[model samples]
Target: MDEALWAVGRGTGVAALVLFTASVVLGIITRSGRPLPGLPRFSVTLVHRNVSLAASLFLVVHVVTLMFDPYALLNLLDVFVPFFGSYRPVWQGLGTVAFDLLIVIVVTSLLRNRLGPRVFKAIHWLTYAMWPIALAHAIGNGTNGVEGWFLVLSGVCVLAVLASFGWRLSSRFVEFRSVRLGEIS
Candidate 1:
């Protein structure tokens, strides 16, 4: 039973990471203002929102399962309180900070309308920070380390982020060209 729970927790964590990667990619593409041919804007937006929600859900499961795992020796406070983990204090603290950032991002998104567009957008940028913090936690404390399928998954996540960022930059170049052309015209 314990093994089963641990496996499930690990799977959930992996799934959450993958969902976050996808969210970052889609967000960059959309923010570039370059419409994807044949893809409705609403559809892309919906996918981005749903992916964020799914990532959050998986994150919650990962945290809860770790707290319950007797071997992990994590308590509820460890989840909420930064750097309180009895084991691997520094690395574990990264997870706590990441959790806090995730909460901020998710809450702001949920109340985006009430928060207004500018405020909501500002908070939303925290997602980029959250990604690196999460990545650091995974790298510093992940039991799997640089082995098996885990390395491949991490590579994919990194590639997705970089690729999206590159696309956004390229789109900006295109926009600049168009603007220059208009000015000349």
Candidate 2:
């Protein structure tokens, strides 16, 4: 039972990280207002939303499984509140912070229609911070943090987000410059 729970915790932790990376990348792509190659912008946005929800599910499983495992040094406070764990305080705290951010992002997103666009957009931007916090926690606390494949995966995830973000920023800058120069009116 213990081993099973531990395995579930480990597997879900990795899965959540992968899914979160996808969510971040997709989100950045979607926000760029560009259609994915061979796909419409709406489709890309839909996939991004679904992927974010799935990542949240995996993250919950990761936390719950660890809490259930006898060997895991996390309590409810540790899982819910940052830096409250008796275990590796800093690393675990990062995870807690990430989870808290995710909760705010998700909840606000769900209530987006009622809360209005400004509120939704404000909370949604937290994904940028949450993803890095989660990645740092995974690298610091993961059992396979130093493994070859894990490093490769992390590199890929980082590059995807950075590239997408770079494109978004550069495009916006170009648009601003164009407008300033009377090129776009």
Candidate 3:
């Protein structure tokens, strides 16, 4: 039972990270209002939403399994309150913080119609912070953090996010400049 729980916990953690990475990339594309080579803009947005939801599901399972695993030494409070765990409190706390932020992001998203665009976008920005915190938690607390395979995987995730983030910023800047030039004209 312990071994099963540990495997599930680790697997889900990795799955959640991958899914979150995809969600962030798709979100950037959605924000740019651009479609992939063969897909429509609406499809991109839909995939982003689905990917985010899937990541959330995996994250929940990861936490649950860890809580049950004796190796983790996590309790209910540790899951919700940051820095409350006996095992690597800071790293575990980061995971809790990320989870809390995710909950807020999800809730606001579900109420997007009621919350209005400004509010929704503001809350959505939390994803930028949450991703890194979750990554840190995975590395600092995960037993496989120093393993070559995990390190390589983490490197790839970091690179993907950095490239996508750069694109997002550049696209926004271009849009701003175009609008300014149009106004001047």
Candidate 4:
């Protein structure tokens, strides 16, 4: 049972991170306004949201299983409150902080109509912060952090995000230049 719980936690955590990486890349793709083949812009938004929800579920499973695992020594407070866990407090606390930011982003998104665009947009931007924080948490706390395969996986995820960021930056620059040259209104 203990081994099963540990494996489940580790598996779910990795799944969540991978899904999160996809979501971030897709979010950037959507923002860049580059229509994917056979995928409309709205579909991109829909897919990104769905992927994020799946990742959230996996993260919940990861946290719950770890909490139940005796080896983790984690309590309820440790799950929500940062820097108080007995095991690897710094890394664990970063996860806590990322979780808190995720809650804000999710809640705001759900209440977006009521909150209006500005607030929702502001909160949604936290994804940029959440991604790196979550990545650091995983790298610093993962069971297989030192493994060659895990490092390669982490590198791929980082590259995906960075590529999206670079593409988005260049696209924005082109748009700004177009505006300056009266090429676009």
Q: Which candidate is the best by lDDT?
A: 3
Which model is ahead, 1 or 4, in terms of TM-score? 4
**Clashes within 3 Å, all models in order:** 0, 0, 0, 0
lDDT: worst 10-residue window of model 4:
171-180
State the TM-score for model 2: 0.90
How far out, in Å, is residue 169 in model 4? 1.8
The best candidate in terms of TM-score? 3
Please write out the lDDT profile of model 1 over residues 53-145, one tens digit for every residue.
899899999989988877777897899888989878778899889889999998888899899988998999998898878877877776764
Q: Candidate 4 on 11-106: residue-level lDDT in tens? A: 998999999999999887766555579997678878988999999999999999999999987789998999899889999999999988898998
Query: Can you give the TM-score per candidate against the true fold?
Result: 0.87, 0.90, 0.92, 0.91
Per-residue CA lDDT of model 2 for 62-168, tens digit only, reads 99989888888678899889987877789889999999999899889889999998889888889889999999988888777778998898899899878877876
Pick the winner on lDDT between candidates 2 and 3.
3
lDDT of 3 at 60: 95
- With a 3 Å backbone cut-off (N, CA, C), the pairs that clash in candidate 4 are none
Error of 3 at 15 (Å): 0.5
Model 3 TM-score, 2 decimals: 0.92
RMSD per prediction, one decimal? 3.5, 3.5, 3.0, 3.1
Model 3 lDDT tens row, 1-185? 99999999999999999999999988887876667899986899899999999999999999999989999988889989999899989988999999999999999999999999899989999999999999998899888877899999999999999999998777342333344357432
Per-model C-alpha lDDT, please?
0.80, 0.85, 0.89, 0.87
lDDT of 4: 0.87
